[model samples]
Target: MRWSNWADTSSVCGIEVAEPAATAEVSALLREASEHGRRVRPIGAGHSFSAVARPVDLAVDLRRLCGVRVIADGGGRVRVGAGIVLGDLNAALAAHGLALPNLGDIDRQRLAGALATGTHGTGGRLHGLASAVTGLTLVTPDGQIHATAPGDGLFEAARISLGALGVVTEVELATVPAFRLRAEEGPEPLDAVLADVDAFVASADHAEFFWFPHTRVASTRRNHRVDDGGGRPLPRWQSHLSDHLLGNRAYELVNRVGAARPGWVPALNRLSAATLGRRTYTDASAQVFCSERSVRFAESEYALPRAAVVPALRDLRAWFDRTRAAVTFPLEVRFLAADDVWLSGAQGRATAYVACHQHVRGGFADVFAAFETIMAAYDGRPHWGKLHTVDAARLAELHPHFEDFLAVRERCDPARVLTNPHLERILGP
Candidate 1:
């Protein structure tokens, strides 16, 4: 069989695949794999651009083990199958008047995949999705089934273990009451936005911006929490036109053109930045948080101390000017509060996540490498699911609890059954 990630940046062939429908089945599969000395990897939605989910020996598909079970009424908590996609989970939670406190812009990632890779949304006061995991059900290599929650030795490490510890079959998440968001988005001078980026991040419930390479403008988005009934959503036609027709289809064409004519990228970027006119609308929290993303691109994101964002952007701008690299995609900037998850990017400090992207058809090696170099000066932590050259040795230096997390991985899967080349590279064998 063959498998490839969403961005087509990673793929594998001739791998044995298993679809496990229940926790017991997952345990059984793991036990069988261990007995035969066959490595096992839990495969999710493949949304990661990195090789994190690339299967080697056996790919354990968890999609069948999916559904949402309310643990308490009135949106307090819920036990969800790790395989449920975020979009589906959001709709399920909405049906129960509950919702995850934060969500990334793309909602196609499986719950486990998102948490495992430390996927996050933008908000200076918010932690990543993994922080919401109050409990988890893991199946270790020897078929051991362990149900862990806070205070349990394995909970924090397993939260963002890059599938190195074990297979996460289910997760118990703390949820918030379903809410709405009033979204305000517009174009602004890049320098001005960067000058007060911290203020902008702290000014709203959720905030982010995108800067087109070679352009002096940025498109900013600020979402504020509102009462459930207060939302005035965009008309269906307008929503489709903006998010689908223009955002994806047109954007795809634009990137293709830029790829074909690198010299035209600057003008194209300016046009792209200018077209992001002002807009405001209110919608359900999930609807406002997530958007349709069909154009595929490889990404490299780093989480730095919030204070380093402006200087990093300035350095990046300088690099672009010096090299005149024709990058077609916009650089996305988001913020997050410090978290305690052992392997999370924002584990110990307020963070500014800067993501650089290049269309698959364009050259990205030099640009991403340059971006990584700039981020390195600020002690940046690479997003585990994105492209980066950092290895476990350097990761150990960056994460204070890196060894501690390794201790948990040792205890859970000492033989390293739930691992791929990527896991070995980032977490060590």
Candidate 2:
């Protein structure tokens, strides 16, 4: 009954128990765990970068307890069980001509889990997945069920609690009409790209880029809203080639070769950047945001001031040039508007998301540390579910409402039964 994270990096303690099949079943399990003074953690597909779902005593798998429940008008919002995977939600919503407004790089996470971490996508004009949540039904430590929405103080705090406040049994998301996006993808020189970064960021409705470290090349992606006029979806075959073949399979092979021979990183990076070709497709926004990420890897991401992206990339490139840190994975850059969620990376100011990944076999300490050090200089906030070394005290300095968030957590789950070792490190006792 050992527990391993999505990346299979953590497996020191804990065991997987039965996954509850319904909301009542989850309520009962939480009550039982509370009576036994056992730490209960609900795991949703285990797709998080942090050990948010890692518990020493018990892990409750939520995949079975998932489906959409009509909450309001047929077109408004739907209540989703915590275990409902994003793919399932997407399919269901598509049937209803609705969808959560935004999504992240991948959509394998269960609804509650995704909400807990404030998982996001790049959109200066839009908000995170957590913001799409209109309400939440949580099983508190005392076994009482509390349902909260827009006006409740609990709503804001619980929406992105990193699984520290309580077990989110179900979530109600404000869905929008399933719309199409015209996606444009191509390569651009990193320097030339950043020279007009602000303009480029403001040009597209949703823009993101990935810079291949050690090379001057980058892949730029833009997804613009398209009129609902009809066109056949990209053929299933083409979708497979674009997502699975080129994005995952071929990309994995390149990273594997680069990881095996560190000295070949620069050449591989150039090839990787050069391989980026222009492609256009019209599909659901969620479909466009997600790409197949089959290759195993660990990630670290931080949110810096939007203005700091170019300088940060420059500093990182300088380090990669002088150091032996040979990383073949491209560095991702995304933008986000300010948010009020206490621990949200985009809190209080527009943010530039800087994310880095390394092959599972590739040791990441040095390069990650280098990135962290540089981000720290810019007062960056780490993504709640991503890798970081900061603790509550350091985090308190960054989050204006840190104490207020803790207060809400205390009132919502006084015993702190939902807190785990990882929570202890980040939120403290």
Candidate 3:
């Protein structure tokens, strides 16, 4: 019933806002919008940096329609309301001795939203979150609900539609028996360790690293399968100190100082990376996958060939050395194998994902631009949920199934009822 004239996403990009409660309401809303010749956009938690969720006319917020339900245990799949956040769902899954096969860095966004944009985490042998989706229930432009699954022509396309095709109501996710992960965190020499990033990625069940920008220091994380030993959880106070204080608070101070005086960033980076110390813990799969990122920063991430990471990062370092712009936040590097999703960044390519972030109020343009330039040379595919400036023409070159996805979108949304201006620009009409 209410709309924001102008809104900004988590990354501070301008957007429009609309609220819708359920699939039926969103269906009727889209139909009415089609009659009036207006565009409709469905938004989740506004976690994306790209304008994909921005609408010029109608914006549909699915926040109120979130819940987790078990549709079929025998089939090893469950139906989750599209708007359910990953954090909430994981808790529910824990109760049922079930968990998602994989997860991204954070769990703040809606399940449908994360899959729609091909959001992913790090694992050489694992696929992305979208790949876990065995089927989905989508509300079409004419207010018809369709259940899609593998082998269905519309299945692959709907798996990662970027909210351009229709409003997704519920998704059937393939799950695994709940498992525990032993997580280890420590500081590593940036140059020495990166010499074999590929091998390291392949060896670890889950591997991700954070390199301090403007410095040769990085934090390495490796998680592997572990027996369910009865290890007690970290005390709330200790967890808060380690995650919130040391990880976010100290990080914020480091950025504030570096932003004010660029020259101080390098030493700060070195110290910050070292300050992570060494940590070891065991937790549920989702708990291990999620990390608290309270420090506000804007990020741009691209997935390139696994072999391209070192050279691309070297090129980025060179750019940083030459440019006057200063970046304080760390750069995160992750890995993922190729996936079947049409719009997935790692589609058909064993990829190394490089993410560059800058302090929210700092000058991120130069560093982000430099990264973009380096990635462009390596046939990089930008994450649709992250910050980028690629349109349909550029995107088509990166994705092999681009045209196929478009055709499916056309069939599902002939009138483009769920499309926003940003979706149109990237996927075209």
Candidate 4:
């Protein structure tokens, strides 16, 4: 069967798909694949837009190794199988009165995929989702399952290694007590939003903004943590209309229209901006953090120094105007605290994430390349799971612990059993 990622941007064909139910089985498969000179790639939910998870010789679909393995004390630590869906894991954790502290809006990714690609949510003090990982069980090139934790160089390297290190079979996450969130969303002028971005980022527990290109307006979302279910959530029908109908279906239709008439992008963005009004509700933290994202798009995101965020946005806007790019998708801006993980985008520095998207109908080469140049100017690091052309040379320059991560990769997989062409491009041959 042909294997393709969710956005259909990355695909690999004529490859063997393996479903090993147990860790030992995974080890055995690894040994077998290696002996036969076959490359093994573990495929998760296929949510990544990049070829980070694309299989060359064998695609080990780990969904078979699903579910929570252990829920450690009320201290809120849970060990989960790598292939468990983030949504399902949230549901399970909710049952135990525990929850992940932060999560990206799209929860369709499997745990392994989410952590591998450095998937994240928006918050000034919060780091990417993978920062929650306290330990992980990694299957080495030699078919040995090794569990790693902090302090050891292996733990840091394995956390966000982009699947170039090994197969992540189990992840131990440090969770938080189940909490509630009060979500407030409204439209604000893009210029006004950027003017006091630092204050805006600091005031809310989580803050993010989306600015449709060629439009003066930005839709801002701020979610605050609460002691209790802060207030009533939206009624079922209201939610259906707001989330399913307007967010996905209507948005998709707008993109379709924009794709057909490139010149109409400015008008469509204005109308889209006008349609977004104020919305407020309170729900479980997980419910408020994750959103329905059925509309497919190809994206490229980069992590910049927190201080460079407003400047970068200003430059991007200038580029959009100068080139008169026919872009209909809004630019997404978010923030994260610095972390110690070896390859995390926000590593060792406060970060602001900027992501641009293009509807899947056509390739985003021109704009994506422009954006890449813009990001490169700000010393930004590309998100692993997103689209980019940066290779090992520039990457080594961007990441301080680059050589350290390479040392660990060599130690863990000396034969390069866990690599593919794309990884070879980013991590070196």
| Best-matching candidate per lDDT | 1
- Global lDDT scores for all candidate models: 0.91, 0.82, 0.81, 0.89
lDDT of 3 by residue, 135-204 (tens): 8888877777788889987888889888877888888888888888888888878887788887779667
TM-score of candidate 2 relative to the true fold: 0.96
In candidate 3, residue 296 scores what lDDT?
Answer: 80
**Clashing residue pair totals per candidate (backbone < 3 A):** 0, 0, 0, 0
What are the root-mean-square deviations of the candidates from the true structure over C-alphas?
1.1, 1.7, 2.5, 1.1
Worst 10-residue lDDT window for candidate 3 reads 3-12
lDDT of 2 by residue, 215-318 (tens): 88779999888877654467899888877887789988888888788999989888878877778888887788887788888889998889998888888888
**lDDT by residue (tens digit), candidate 4, 31-119:** 88888888888888998999999998898888987778556452778888898999999999899888899999878999998898889
Q: Is candidate 2 or candidate 4 better by lDDT?
A: 4
Candidate number that wins on lDDT, 3 or 4: 4
Q: Which ten-residue region of model 2 has the weakest summed lDDT? A: 9-18
